[model samples]
Target chain A: MAKGTILSIDAMGGDAAPGVVVDGLAALLADRADISVLLHGNEPVLAPLVAAQKALAGRCQIIHSDTVITSDMKPSQALRRGKGSSMWNAVEAVKNGEAGAAVSAGNTGALMAISMLILRKMEGVHRPAMTALWPTLRGRTVVLDVGANLEADAAQLVTFAIMGEAYARAALGIAKPTIGILNIGSEEMKGHDEVREAHEWLRAAKLDIDYRGFVEGDDISKGAVDVVVTDGFTGNVALKAGEGVARMLGSRMREALTASLMTKIGAALAMAGLKTLRSQMDPSNVNGGVLLGLGGVSVKSHGGTDARGFARACELAADLASSHYRDEILANLARIREGGLAAE
Target chain B: MAKGTILSIDAMGGDAAPGVVVDGLAALLADRADISVLLHGNEPVLAPLVAAQKALAGRCQIIHSDTVITSDMKPSQALRRGKGSSMWNAVEAVKNGEAGAAVSAGNTGALMAISMLILRKMEGVHRPAMTALWPTLRGRTVVLDVGANLEADAAQLVTFAIMGEAYARAALGIAKPTIGILNIGSEEMKGHDEVREAHEWLRAAKLDIDYRGFVEGDDISKGAVDVVVTDGFTGNVALKAGEGVARMLGSRMREALTASLMTKIGAALAMAGLKTLRSQMDPSNVNGGVLLGLGGVSVKSHGGTDARGFARACELAADLASSHYRDEILANLARIREGGLAAE
Candidate 1:
């Protein structure tokens, strides 16, 4: 059993909050007997739900908060008026050492802003990046700067490389993950000056990571590299584009399968195969996005995810917390600083 | 018969070279009796191949060029020594007005450099973008800056919006194509300054296109808009990411279908549905990437494509030339200029 680990939860976050939150907690508690949860939300709303869930009754402790961070609130507005809010209180637990990590399914921008403001940046870290666990043919790969910082310089990109490598080690359990900078082409001359400069930096840096040169967009799904790094804007677009294609193909496949009676019977016969495909491509299986480069481990769950998905996010948070992800990142940054490899 | 339409072909551009090029031309000629072709390559090699195909003998005119642009040649080197080469001659024929359009399956960087040098940019167009025909749930949509120029300003993005709209109208037959700027989120406050600024300009510009504000990456394949405009870097990454996801799903599906004997039997029974799905997702069906913002239409076929794919490229080039795609782009640019909407 995992010891001295507690995950702070924003109970009122996400589209279908409170209910899904309670159910997800119940599921997580049933799956693992080692971890405890700190639920932050309105007492009246969460008290009954936690009481109803037999699995969560003893394992969960609710912290009453009257305010909820609305999805539509701007980052700046949220910062000014979000005190005592469920999201803010959850993150505060991480800052105050009351919990090992915090998980919230709220406005991404607000969450990022609050995480940055409260937890503060790690030593020698210029920008904090959001890392996502991308499913690939081999297993899973880590993709960072998904939407944390819109634009990144050559130095920031190199920083992302180090951060993502550390993230893969902690979350994905890859001891020495291969890393690649995402570019239009794999050639050294393919991308812009920033990407080229970062490529050079990574090549020269004496890091524990197996720094593979450059990888293209297709390489992400092929699992050509364990960690794919890029600017937030490009990463975000690529992530969404990949998802879009999956959805498009899935829908088209469904239409074709149902178009004829013969194909429908074939689908029934191949029920096991179809089930395998669904589980492999299901978004709920990989639902957490970790905010790296901060002093504490913070996770952002998809606001629209269901109970199963939320449970996956909680598992991700617990894993990061137990692994001492923040300490690993700090040590890496410290080594880079000592080596005089700062991008600035 | 379509009168005075001729497509200049770089016979030695692609991986399969003259074989696929000749076969593709034959396929195109069989489908359309109205078009003529200028085949540029070694006459000795191309002559025997062309003679074997009775359909191409009359309609094809051989323009012998000894030099073939190797795939690895740098753009600068190709520009310096590419004169009289097959790819060079094809673009030259367009510049010299002997051919209405040029089609090449050569190095993309070399092709773009040579095309820009020979054909020149349309008036008021700062950067010429590479537009691709992206297959969507509802037929096809046009996506631009697939890697033409790495970075773009607000003005250049607006230009892409216009160029993509015109291409969709000519190629996809969409009367008033809906246009959207690709960004991390659909909100106006989501992306960087340039994207936000371009969104504003597109909104204010009095154009024929139906401006649908901002769109995320998923919107591209959802058929939410007829034209998705973005910078070269983001567009290139998104395009490749989409391709990667398609390939990933395909390989995974095959694995699942062949896992056991029952599933294999099911696969055989559902072979027809699978065939339909394959065709719908096949990249070769839409193999051409049209170079927009040039005075003469230039279509780029994938270097690795086969005879059927090269034929699709020829069809795209011929279609654009016959539809007066260049004139339509110029008129739109003129409208934006008259409305004082230049990004510069």
Candidate 2:
């Protein structure tokens, strides 16, 4: 069993929160013996849900909070104003070391802002990058700055590369990940001035990363490289578009199968393969997004995640806590600083 | 018949060109008896491929050019050196009035650069935006500045919105296309300085475009809006990532189906449904990336297009030639310019 005693879960966050959060924690408690959960939300509202789940009665400790940060709140303002809110409390628990980790499905901007303000970044780390595993054709690739630092300098991009490589090693279990700079073209002379300058700096430097040259946008899922590094603005766009494509393809497949009698017949004949495809493409399995460079473990699940998806997020957080990712990242930063290579 | 006489095709461009080009032209010619093709490539190399198609024997004409512009060539060098290259010849043909439309599956930058230099922009248009239709859950959504102007200002984004809406009307058959700016958040206050300023400008302006509101990246394939406007860099990244996700999801589905014996049994049961899904996501159906705001009709296909994809590109080009897209874009540009909006 892992040594982590408690995990603070934001009950009032996400599109399908409270319910899914209760379901996930209840399911997790039945299996995980060492871990306990502190459900942060309205006490009166959540007590019934906990009482309904016999297995979760003693496993979860409810911390009643009246305020709930909705998805529409301005992240910076909400963090400053809504201190006693469920999302804020959950993150605060992790910050105070009262909880092993904190998980939220609330306003992403709010979560990011609150976390940054409460849990200051590690030494030598300028900004925290939101990293997620993008399921690719070859396998899965770790993409960083998915929606964290929108306006980043070349130094930030370099830091993103280092932190991304470390995250890949901790999360994905890849020892030596091949890193690629996401650019408009694969050629060395392509991209904007900043990208071009970064390319030269990375190529010239004796970095620990395996810089496998530049990669175009299409190469992200082709497994052409292991880690794709870019600023938050572009990374966020790519991530969202990727999600859109997955949803589009899935819906189109369903529509095509139900288009006509012949297609329906074809759909029936191909049920085996179709089921396999559906399960593979389902967002539930890959629901967690890691907030890398944070002082503690925090994951952001999908807004509309169901019970299974919520369970997956908790499961992911448990794995991350066990891996000691925070410690590793700090150690990496220390090493970079000691080597006199830390970004100024 | 569509009345357009000559169509210039880059015979030596694309992965399976010459063969694909001839096959596409032959198939198109069979349907439209009035159109003639000006095939650009090495005459000796393309002769046999042309000979293989009986309908293309003497019905099509060849503009012999030994030089070729590769997909990897720099835009400036390609434009400077590639005088008789396939893409160059195709654009030249359009400029010289030898062809009503030009289609190529070569370097996008080269095509854009050559088109800008040779045929030039339409009246009152400063820059041309490349637009492509993304297959979405709601339907097909037009995304513009797919890689045209990398560092676009507020006015350029407005131009994209105007041009994209016009393209949507001409191509997707939408009467009053709902136009939305792609931002990090959907709120009016979201995004960078450029987006914020543009939002205000678009909101205050009186134009034919149905300015819906701000949209996030995921909204592209959700069909939330008819036209998704973004700068070239963001648009390109989003477009490619979408493609990557579709390809990635398909591969993951295949892997899942072939994982084990029980899964294989499940796969066998659902084979027909799977085929239908694959057909829907197939890239062949969506081939053309139309270069909007250009003086003449020009379509850019994938650098690695097959025969069916090439044929789709030609079909899209032909369709554009028959539409009033050119005049509509010109009028729209005039409207925006008359409103006294600066480029920045």
Candidate 3:
């Protein structure tokens, strides 16, 4: 685990898997100079591809996986009959200490199911929450659970805060990440019972981290906080809704630029600045979604992303693995328990 | 109702209360030749404002109101002590058939509470849903339960679909709107119990509405379906998240355009197209949120919007009141009852 260089990869997972996976691994190795891979997928499909990647010469090894998980497979179905699958083996590698982190772009539900089954939740952690790094106006914000479980109680929300806060610290190198619950309004009594209870708990708990009061959905991208916590159901919808609107606006902008020759010339003259804006809003730039609260880091790349995006996921995994965020989470939870807000 | 020309105005609500209200009413009256206003608030504050509006000379009346509902007031509090407030008086005008509809830019929770308490729920309706008109790539999509109540059961979702469908038909003028339930994934068993049950009921029920199976969050602004249905919590989050991202991107684009002298010149040359894009994403263009399932048409404008936005809300109020959307809802409910999916 030196520098957290080794990563387990589900090479047969995403829309253009195996190819993008190998290419992404090669890209990561070239970029990081201190990374290796435990590539898991069909041997015949991946071996030649990995052999062709010059960067994979000494740093990568193919771990043959007999089964491939489809995008439509149910999590329950994955749990019962998904042993030896590429996603399963990838996560198992992390569990066995062969790799510090696992990366996949497979079926989200199935991935979460297999991930939880293989890399069980950490001690005192109620459930594993999916993580999304939202690029805000200020910088980047960490939002969870984008889709882990359907609902969360007040206690579970507290766990999300600990994990999410640690992620902001570890991944973004923030000193003391500000945390807020995602509610309909900043008002204490705006949301349901669960969010209110969690808000109260966070406010009352004597934790080392900074606990900002409630934030609304619009606060996610405005960088109102470093970490925004919410149940998976609401988080997933928010993430996707933000994504959809971004894409819509991006398309509209593109159309506007192309609508006339003058605007097209304007776009050309302003290419550098516009490109900066585009990169800032690119999904690939923020492709990795860390599955938090698990025993090992598991980064889920966007399924439709290319090698560049997957490489970003690998970078995120390496960052999370090498950082002291996990230790921070343990300490925060201990603080909560000490404050009598969480069970020992 | 004379083509729904008459609207009751809450002159003492919103961030800039009587000023914006009167100005927006004046704007709407100037735009639409047939419209009239029953302006309700402190007559002393509104009298001079109305006198200043040239459009209000022949077609406006100020009704005195003793109370003004503040944005910080809770729904329960609004219900108990809000009877003679401007919002209450405005909605009462609709209930008493003095106006075709009521328009208010006020506290959403308080507005919903007061509207329901005074206007009451329509026959066979479980709860009122706050509607948001999402500007999609294709045109627009009607999303419901933006925040009337939090959670909804399958029966309530069916009602949302019905009301959302009728809203699309009435406001957007779609003949038969396609409907979808928002979920994490598009699969049948992808989401929580409530969404799944609602999907199943929508699929099974015999209705004239086009029932698409399921839509993910990204499909909302993509116009994958004409109407999207979900619990209020999810809907509210989605709406705000979309708004947040749009605003963030907008700010970023502005920054990028002004980053360099060349880009500034390019932006100046491309100002017209960018303005079109800005108007397309403007909050004022989509300001109104219809409180459906109430006995009378009551539209809630964005609390922070300007006079232009309030005017847009008034237009939506007029549209809903004039159209046969309510009868369509009643018919759809009757159809659901006949199909044995809902209670009589």
Candidate 4:
């Protein structure tokens, strides 16, 4: 069992709330014997669910809270009236050093707002970024700033590269991760002013990163590099667009498989192979979005995701918690700072 | 026969130029009895190929051009020395009123630069945007500003919405096409200042377009609206990222179908249905990138696309030439200016 890595959970958050949360916790505990969780919600509702799951019984600790943060609540509303709420307490556990990380499937903006307020940004970290593991032809690539902020300046982009390199190590276990900043073209003079400026700084900074300069959007699927850095607006759009295409193809494939009796029989015959493809292609399998450059480890799962997805988010958070991810980022930032590189 | 809409072809451009160009012209001629072409390239090289095609024998007129613009040449360099080049001659045909539209499967930057110089921007247009028809769940949606210019301010974004609406009417045959500006969220208050400002102008402007407030990235796949408007940088990234995910899913699907003997047999049984699905998903079928806000119609085919893809580009150009696409945009822009809306 992995010792001293307890994850705090917002049990009353997400679309399927307490049910999926408890079920996901059970599923996670079943796979990993070393982990434990501090479950935050109304204990009256969650206590029974925990008791029912044999794997979750002794490994879970329920923290009672009166109110729950609704998914539709604005970030401002969440921060103002969210004291003693289930979601707030879950993150409070991480700030208090009672848990290695906090896992939430609640409102994304709320989670980001709350995390920033409670844990604070890591020392020297300008702004936090939302990082997600993008599945590629080879494996998974870490992509950052998936809607954390609207714009990222050249200096902030360089910071993203430094943090993304550390993220790659924690999430994918790549020793020296190759990083690429997302742009329209790979040429040195291509793209907006900030990206070009970011490129030069990263190339000259001599940071502890294998910076591969600029890469286009297609590089994400090609898995041409390990880490992809971009501003939040572009990153968010690209991320969602990728998801949109994946869903479209999946739907089309289903229609094709059931078009005729012969095709139906064929689908049955090829069920195993199809299942293998489906497993990897499903967004639920890759549900975790890690909030990087934070003082503590924080993973946000999709609100609409199911138990399997929530469990996957937990696993990703566990990976970050157990590694020296934060330390590596600090060290990398120091190198850039000491060199006086990526100056605004 | 649909008459009076002849397309000028850049026969010496693209990755498989002369071969794909002649073949694509033949394909386009075979499909539409109303269309003719002024095939521009080295007469010695193109004349023999055109002779072989029954469709091209009478309808095609060869225009000799000694120079061919290489795909890697920069836009500025192309502008300086691309005189009498095949690409330049094709657009020249449009300017001389010899052809209704110009079709090029060449270096995108060079083609855009050449077209801008020859046809020039339409009256009251700030900047011309590159538009493409995206395959959606319903039929098609027009997405614009795909890497024409990096930054689009509030006014530029609003201009895109105006141009995109007209482009949809031409390309997709949707009268009063429902339009949307792409953003991270559908909420009016979400996203950057430019998008939010553009959204207000579009919703309040009361132009000919049926302006739907805001759309997310996934809305493209969902076919939620007729046209999606965005800045060059965001649109370009979204377009390529969507393509990347589609290609990734396609490769994975192929792997699944051939994974085992049983799966291969299953794939064979479902071949017809799968082909139907493949036909719709194939990028070649929807290949043209129409340069909107230009005085004349110009459609850019993918440089790496095949003969079928080139033919599709010609067909899209033909659609624009035959319709009042340019007039609609001019009228719409005039309305915005008269109202004193979308002020910087």
- How much of the real interface does each model capture, measured as fnat? 0.73, 0.48, 0.71, 0.72
**Chain B TM-score of every predicted model:** 0.97, 0.93, 0.96, 0.97
lDDT of 2 at B128: 85
Query: Which tens-of-lDDT digit does each residue in A158-204 have in candidate 1?
Result: 88888888788878888889999999872335898898888988787
CAPRI-style grade of the A/B interface in model 4? medium
Sort all candidates by TM-score, best to worst: 4, 1, 3, 2
Candidate 2 residue-wise lDDT at A80:
68
Task: Evaluate all candidate structures by whole-model CA lDDT and list the values in order.
Answer: 0.88, 0.80, 0.88, 0.88
Model 4 residue B204 lDDT score: 79
**lDDT tens digits, residue span A1-344, model 4:** 23667999999889999899899989999999878999999999998898999998678999999998887888889999999998899999999989999999988888888999999999887789988889989889989898888889999999898899988888888999999999996222498889999999998887878999888888899999999999999999999888888888888889988989988998888887899999988778888998788899888999998999999999988898999989988898888888888363
**Alpha-carbon interface RMSD of model 3?**
2.0
Would candidate 1 be rated incorrect, acceptable, medium or high by CAPRI criteria?
A: medium
Off by over 4 Å in 4: A186-189, A342-344, B1-3, B186-189, B342-344
Clashing pairs in 4: A2-A34
**Looking at model 4 chain B, which ten-residue stretch has the lowest summed lDDT?**
B180-189
Question: Best-fitting candidate, measured by TM-score?
Answer: 4
How much is the lDDT of residue A194 in candidate 1?
A: 90
Error of 1 at A233 (Å): 0.8
| Best candidate according to DockQ | 1
Candidate 1 residue pairs in backbone clash = B155-B343
Residue range B201-267, candidate 3, lDDT tens digits:
8888888889997788899989999999999889988999898998899999999999999999898
Q: Which pairs clash in model 2? A: A270-B270, A270-B271, A270-B272, A271-B270, A272-B266, A272-B269, A272-B270
